[model samples]
Target: MTMRQHAVSDDFLRPDSINAFTDALRGAKYNVDAVLERLGEAGQEGLTRNQTMPALDRLGDATDAQADLIRLFPLQQIVPRSRLAAFLDVPALIEAGVLGAIGREGIHADIDVRPYGFTDAAGEWSGWVAADPIPGMDSIVTRTRPNYVLGVSPASTSLAQLTVPDRVGSALDLGAGCGVQSLHLARHADTVTLTDINPRALDMARLTLALNGLDLDVRAGSFYEPVAHDSFDLIVTNPPYVMSPPTDAADRLVYREGGFAGDGLVRHVVREGASHLA
Candidate 1:
């Protein structure tokens, strides 16, 4: 089978693979800079600070240039394309050499085929594509739909940062999402249970925890159903608190809607959580 076929068979879009891709793109950014500098030496007006700075930003991930490079290059040429781009930005990163071969049978094949595109408010060219996945993250929610609980939101990070560490017996992470809070709690707790109604989110939580080298108990069930009653020393939940009507009830997925109106889920979790706590 062809490399593309092999990649498709394997799901290579894991977090690590994304990181590698991003690193290569960063290398490309340096190459681009050198070219711009040479252009300045030749009195070709060089890249304007404004034009050039954005290209540097584009090297990170999911930008127009990265996407275009992915689409333009042959399958076998991806790593080299990435390296060439990297060499353009930072010559030092390319000293070890560009990738000569990509393992066809990898888990993140779809990421290679998927195109990353972006548009600004005035619809100007945002010439950048993500060459790597965000560390510890898989997919980002780009669309705002009703019943869609925002994942990795600032609020979740805030709560995670504010969490008080304790040498607890057990902890429960309700609506774990990406498992950020659960992973945080794992530092101090003996065991952490990450629960989420969305299986996809749960999968990501598992990956995130494992990536961090923490062995966590990942369960998929509606809030509180997966755990034994009164089993946890502490329970932390960032429930679906959006007050808007769901775009589709089936799409509620428990991440956005609490199934109760107006902080009902939060209140229920608070009330029920008291019972679940040891």
Candidate 2:
């Protein structure tokens, strides 16, 4: 297994380029419902298993805008520059750090771009999330990265659904990896603060927010230190709960395994949550 760190430039956050990228995504029907509908049960299951062949088979050889986007994003399959250029601003994608170009025709994504959405009492939340592709995904080819930021996970969806969507004055996403929780919170909170220990996660979260046309206060600190001096009307977190036993740094993953042991991290959050909650 080969391990690699995720890298992308801040230029990806340029408003005009991001707008064009998102517009193309919407025009291609790259949303939760459409992508899943196209993938079917087998393909969906394959994705869950970190297997791409089934989904690739389902997608077939179609180079249509949506299929190409699907292939490029979630599937982690590289697309030929010419194919993507059919619908996307290819040069802008390269310049925006969405894809790499060595003056070559192959376009590859170092990170993952996923379409996420949920409807709440406030309104509809539909947008893309940009995060480091979780390590060990496509398990055969990838290994863990020390500070990998997770995109949307099963827990992410459940948490989003579980959180009460009532409007609030301010909210904090305590461990906002890729800002998934913030996407939901931003709609209801007049202000949202995202804090994470890993700087990479903070970057990914910021990228996620920028892509979604939402901006929030992002700070770097483990747990609550960044917001220790402040409180909010609502505080939300989907923390690392893998409960892994002690291991070397090689075995630790920031998104799942915190420096704390077992559920200590979770316990600390629960124990200290009230003090920060308004």
Candidate 3:
């Protein structure tokens, strides 16, 4: 059987290419501390609420590589080709499917990439995450795109922090959007498998893990279907738990809605997710 390729094909999936992409990002100083320092106090605070304008304003006219990447990504601003090339090799990133040229406006991020950092008993870990943009507060009502894969958020951090720091032989991150939980699980588990119903989520998860020089088994399936009749030493997931009345909303966001009735998805995970856990 042939497997479906996710996002930009598998041409750029090689370790050498992934490592090059990682090097470029590292050279530009894309990290949590750098981003916070660039955004200043107000902008940093604004980001917690999904606001980026303040950070954008602070980054005004800054052609520095880090600034250029920030504008192109988390801020979702298009930047000039020359400026973007100053910090990043536009051609290489384009080949890696990380950057795309948008007409004469120069370059923009093909994916949402941002620095994520956290502390555990093992000390602190920091890395970049990639995913589709979250519906910003001002734009939520106008969002019309369904299947929007989510980037890093408070919930991801909370779950990572709350998790027990136990070593395990294998781990499964269900609904592994952008693979943040799976990334954490890699540090403790001998093997990690990331599964998601959304194909784009799986694609982004694969890229997210690769960008960090980590490898895991990525599968496309709803919940435990991908691992049928199998179990793991650990299972971690923050399934869609939103509680709201159904509406004919144009944007049928998969990241926020689990297709089941309100909160029912959460219940289903609670009831059935254990079957996949060792």
Candidate 4:
């Protein structure tokens, strides 16, 4: 797709754009049933674990002629938000049995859900809190702070942007939250290993890669645990650096806490990374 075809202005999230996107999805067969299933699943769970590309790919596989039709739809083009939310909302509506499909007139239902901005790291994105029970995972709603450390922060993006691009080499991204750095590095790196201490973050990173059509190895473990020594030409980490109070152990989310006092996490990573670098 051309830049203009995919590019949406800052105001792209307006009601009109959403209506257009809904109409486009409703017109496609794969979008109708599959998107509904996804949204329904999301309502039961806070998020969807399955990636979006496979469903789109399955649409193509189901019918040869529809493959090109799916390509032309460009759901991402109408609104540059995370595909996970889009996929989840559709299924949520379908599962509720409130709408047969996302017709233009039915767009109001989405607005009612109050899809507001959740994080603004690499791109503008929004998330909706499901009122219904989240499937499989615990139903506990995670309370988030300003989270100077959660999601994709500026430090992570800066490392990614500053890294040399358009080169082929194996790269390792330690603590790859949301996979922003890994995704940018993928522009030049042949392969990327995204390691994270939190499985939820790895899950989000996988969704990010899927949305962008980029592939990376998503492993759940502490820094460098999933990777071999002397295997990476480039290793990058934007670790948890915030200092928390001694009594407020609950304040430290897995993505934000280093399990050490002061800059101990950073120091440890630097020392350990030296041994792993190729």
For every model shown, what is its TM-score relative to the native structure? 0.53, 0.90, 0.89, 0.50
Q: Between prediction 2 and prediction 4, which has the larger lDDT?
A: 2
For residues 114-199, write the lDDT of model 4, one tens digit per residue. 11132223454322211111112233344453222244445765776667654658888898866677766665678888898765
CA lDDT of 27 in candidate 1? 46
Please give the range of 10 consecutive residues that has the lowest summed lDDT in model 2: 1-10
Give the Cα error of residue 21 in candidate 1, in Å: 11
lDDT of each: 0.49, 0.82, 0.79, 0.49
Whose TM-score is higher: candidate 1's or candidate 3's? 3
Against the true structure, candidate 3 reaches a TM-score of 0.89
lDDT score at residue 183, model 4, on the 0-100 scale: 60
Error of 3 at 36 (Å): 0.6
Give per-residue CA lDDT, model 3, range 177-248, as digits (tens).
889998789888999989998888888888888778887899999989999988898888888866872456
Please give the lDDT score for candidate 1. 0.49
- Model 1, 32-84: lDDT tens per residue? 34334423432222122213223333333543444334322212123333434
- Poorly placed runs, candidate 1 (over 4 Å): 1-151, 251-254
